[model samples]
Target: MKKSLLMLNAILLLTAVSCKKSTEGGNTGIIKTDSSTTIVTDKNGKVDSLSESSTIVDVNGKKYEKTDFVYKATDGTLVKVIFKNDPKESTVAITSNKKTFTLPKVESKGGETVYKKDDMTARVKGDSLHLEQGNNIIELKRTKI
Candidate 1:
C-alpha cells in the first residue's frame, strides 16, 4: 500500500510540474528566413509585411539588385513578387497559386510600373498590384515591403 501511494504521489508531482504555466510572453514582432526575407507579424499572429533585399551575381561577375514584396488578395490569397534589376535588363517574377511567372519590364512612369509576358500583364502602383490574364483579373494589396 505504501509503495502504491508513493508511486501515485510521484506521478501527480510530475504531472503538476509538466503542466505549470509559463511566465514568458508571446512571440516578438519579426521573423527572418534563410533566404534573407524578413516577415513582420503582430502580437495576434497576423502578418504585417515581408521584404527581401539582396544582391545577385551573374556568370559574368555582374551584380544585380533584387527585391521582393508580398501582397494579399481580398480573399486572403497571397502573392509574392520579385524584381531583379541590372544595367542591361530588368525582370519581375510573380508567384501565385504555386505558379511563378516571369515578365520583362515594359514601362515605368509616374510611380507606376508595368510588366508583360505574352497576354498576361502586371501593374504596380503605390501599395496595390493588378494582374490580368485574358479576361480574368486579380488585385492584391501590399502586405509587406
Candidate 2:
C-alpha cells in the first residue's frame, strides 16, 4: 500500500512540473525542431519543452517543421518564411522577387529572426521585414487592418 501511494505521488509531481507555463522571449507560437527534439513556445513567448513534434518532415536526415510565418506587404507583396527550427539550420525558404528563395539561419542578434543565403539576407524587426543584398535594403511593413 505504501509503495502504491509513493508511485501515485511521483506521477502527480511530474504532471505538475510539466504543465508549467513557458516564457521564452515574449514571442509565442514558435516551434523549433531538429531530428530528435522539438522546442515549443507558448502564446506568451515562453519555452515549453524540449520534445519531438508530430508534424515533422525529414530532410537531409533532419526534421523540418510545418509551422511557418507569413507577412503581407502594403504593395501586395507576400513574403513567406518556412522554418525547420534546427539550431544550425533553421530556415527552409524565404519569398522574394516573386520567387521563393531557399536559405538558412545565419547570425541571429538581439533575439530577432534573421535568415541568409550567400549574399542575401532577410531580417524581421517587429512589424517590418527587411531584405538586403549588396548595398540595397528593401523594407516591407505590415499594414494595420
Model 1 superposed RMSD (Cα): 17.2
Which residue pairs in candidate 2 have backbone atoms (N, alpha carbon, C) closer than 3 angstroms, thus clashing? 22-46, 23-46, 24-45, 24-46, 24-47, 27-45, 38-51
- TM-score (all chains, Cα) for each model: 0.61, 0.49
Residue 113 of candidate 1: its Cα lDDT?
A: 88
Q: Among these predicted structures, which one has the highest TM-score?
A: 1
Residue ranges of candidate 1 with Cα displaced over 4 Å: 1-50, 56-59
lDDT of 2: 0.59
lDDT string, candidate 2, 1-114, tens digits: 455445544754797698554556543344433335345574477764322222465555655555445555556654555556653557646654447787677767775778
lDDT by residue (69-91, candidate 1, tens digit) is 77788877666688888788889
**What are the lDDT scores of the predictions, listed in order?**
0.70, 0.59
